[model samples]
Target: MVQCLSHRVELAFKDAMKKAPLYSKVYSLMDELFKFYHKSAKQSAGLKSSFEALNITPCTPTRVGGTRWLGHTLTALNNIWKGYTAIVKHLSQVSVTTGQSATQPKALYLLKLLRSNDVITFAHFLTDVVAVLAQLSKALQKRETCLYEVHQQLLATISNIKKFQTRPGPELRKVQRPDGSFAGESLTGDTTQHSAQMPKLLTALVETLDRRFSDIDEGVLCATKLADMNAWPASLEDSTNG
Candidate 1:
């Protein structure tokens, strides 16, 4: 059986990002954050010195080029999600000290977006959804992976996504930061809109999986489990019957 290691995860992630509505805004924020960080580092040693003095290494966002493979997209998403707080902290300082609005309008806009409630919740939502797909993507690429395992993983992923969709309210409300006094930007009328669309996004993800892997046989997936010695039936006839 051929492994369908195509762009299933990539497509799902892309779809989720698209459905988010605010995804482009989040990405733009990351881009501006990195650009401002780089510009600051280059223009004034004070920026770099301050970061070092605080022992917080400045993080830059990785671009998720469509031409690149799935791993690149996952990496880019992870970079922004993981370094979110640090990016916010530095940019907040930059805004205060340098008047980011005059020097870099995009960065200023991004900084505002990052502090907003909708963006925070959406970011958390993406991180949770994409992280599961990322794990499955890595497992599927392994040389020894089998059809049955792929089937199992897909079902598990679908279930997890559905679970996420049902109760995304808390995730879309706030960002938890212990030290920072940053209040999230309120999305006003958008709160309900974002909550409503999450389920549809997850539904699309499930439909994509069903569409892409429809040719995979259930019988074959079941039988492939016998390949594991630990899971073999007691007798040959039992295995065949199952």
Candidate 2:
């Protein structure tokens, strides 16, 4: 099974090389994405806060509702749609913005995955995304005095968790500081404390940011070094599956 899949991947790459124009076409198409889809903006875009940009609130992923306000979540890919801006109404639905008939590379790739009885897609990442965005939206609704600071700290903790992978040890301690904040807590104080049971949500945000960092090349963002390094550590899948 592994050998067959490896051969398929090799064929895809070899065919892609032959059709270099096609590969470049797709690669160029993806160029615009990094400009709009940065780690700092993804949660905001996911929350789609233009409607009530100021009054975000705390809620679970199931309770959160802002998927409709952004118009098209895939708006970054404008050329594929022939410049038509269609709003995406559902998350689980296969995208409709790729202006192509049957058997288009991207569209068919997605369709094939959807039809497959046993396969996984990153779309499942959406589930983890909802909780993170919901928490972030709540922060935006109010004055964000410490979110950035806490969020950075959260990333560090996520790194520790990923690195350790919860090595066997004595009973985990509460590990709270004098300030009433959890020892490795990302956001501190009551502002972030009001509804902070969503550690899973925060972890998801960290992982998404990691993916964004993976896309950056020589640390340049429009001639500026956006981030020096990807600090999120190994992914959970690599830590466990590998």
Candidate 3:
């Protein structure tokens, strides 16, 4: 039952993100990019070569699919973020490869989409958000986790995600200046509009979490904490009076 609830929350998160245009586009592009290399031996080899050239460890792109759990989604996002430079280089080289003219335009388009400031920002932001969700999901699946523990962890995860409204995650902070300006080589244009969308995205996520978990009996869950011996009153008289 706990594992099921966790999956429901993750699905709610995906639904909420799909409602946002920026996130929708970013995730779609991630899936497309993964498929672009995944379908071809030549492209995959070129990507590995690019990784080697840049001194990045060779790793395959993981697909972001609807059927995947949040942990898999997080892995896919992290893979993309880590291979950002190598992916760009590989795509650039592939776009000019001879005899692969048909793949050239597609590769170039994916490259252009991946390099957009909005895409870069939200991609990193998602990695951070999903990381939190993934951890919660992993915890809830543990055999030792009880109802009260699940409730506590769920609330804690929500609180941590809400903090993103004011303070962006480490991955996001790396590409953003203290003054709220874009600070990376991948970003060149004014991203004020895109940056403004982050809070709204986080709002959607928090609201979804609250709504999805509403069915869980919080009062009952809280009451379960009393079962813990550590939560008992120190004196027998105090316990009797209570």
Candidate 4:
């Protein structure tokens, strides 16, 4: 049952993300960027060199496996966020060094996409959103967790996510300008079209959570809380008096 709930939540998140235009593109880009380096020893070497040149610690991008769930996606996004400069640098070098080869054009295209405001904004937003979902995913997998605790945690997660409608995540806040445009290296300072989409995406996710968990009997789960001694009255007199 625990595993089933976990899978259901992850699938719900995936569905929500895929249906959101901004999120879908950013997610796909993450997978594409990882593969760009994964399939090429030369590009991987270039990425390492870029890291060294920029005095950043070397780390490889993680594969966003189709079946691995949101935790893996979080890791992949973290990798991209941490190594964004290194990736841009590597791609810049590849575009020039590869001359007229097909690799140069592909490298240039990816560089353009990665540096855009929409990708940057939505990618950071997802990093924050998925980080929350990933926490619930981890908690649900614990051996000692009970259905009552799971119920509480699910409610808490939904509440936390709804807050994102007004409060942007730490990562997403970094690139946003006061005027509603986004500012970052190579970004064109255009008003972020993606920021508007965040609320809709979050709403969809909350709805999905509600729909998916609707069948669970909250009253039954509440009753199970009595199994915990901590949930019991401190003394028999208190219980009888109540």
Best by lDDT: 4
Per-residue lDDT tens digits of candidate 3, residues 1-242?
87777687787787668546777767777788888889998889989999899898987788876553787788887787778788888888888879888899998888777767777777778888888888888887777888767667778898999988888888887766644333234454556646777777788888888787776656765587666566689999989999
For model 3, the local distance difference test gives 0.77
Q: Distance from true position, residue 168, model 1, in Å? A: 5.3
TM values, all candidates: 0.70, 0.22, 0.86, 0.87
The residue pairs in collision within model 2 are 150-186
- TM-score result, candidate 1: 0.70
- On TM-score, the stronger of 3 and 4 is 4
**Taking the tens digit of each residue's C-alpha lDDT, what string does model 2 give over 1-242?**
22222222223222323322222332332332232223334332543442134233421121111232111222322222221111111111224534433313433343333322111111222222222333333333444333233334334534543432233111112222244322122222232321232234334434544443332233332223223233333687765765
lDDT by residue (131-193, candidate 4, tens digit) is 999999888878877877777788889998998998988988887766443333557445356
lDDT of each: 0.61, 0.29, 0.77, 0.79
Task: Kindly list the per-residue Cα lDDT of model 1 for residues 1-242, writing each as its tens digit.
Answer: 33345456666567655665777766676556555556664524544454566576644566555543456555665666556565555555666765445655554576677766556556666666666777777788787887667767777878877887656534333443443223432232234544566677778777776766665545665577566565668899998999
Q: Which stretches of candidate 3 lie above 4 Å from their native place? A: 66-68, 177-184, 218-222, 228-242
Looking at model 3, the pairs that clash are: none
Return whichever of 2 and 3 wins on TM-score. 3
Clashes of each: 2, 1, 0, 0
Ten contiguous residues minimizing lDDT sum, candidate 4: 180-189
How many Å off is the CA of 71 in candidate 2? 12
Backbone clashes in candidate 3 total 0
CA lDDT for candidate 4: 0.79
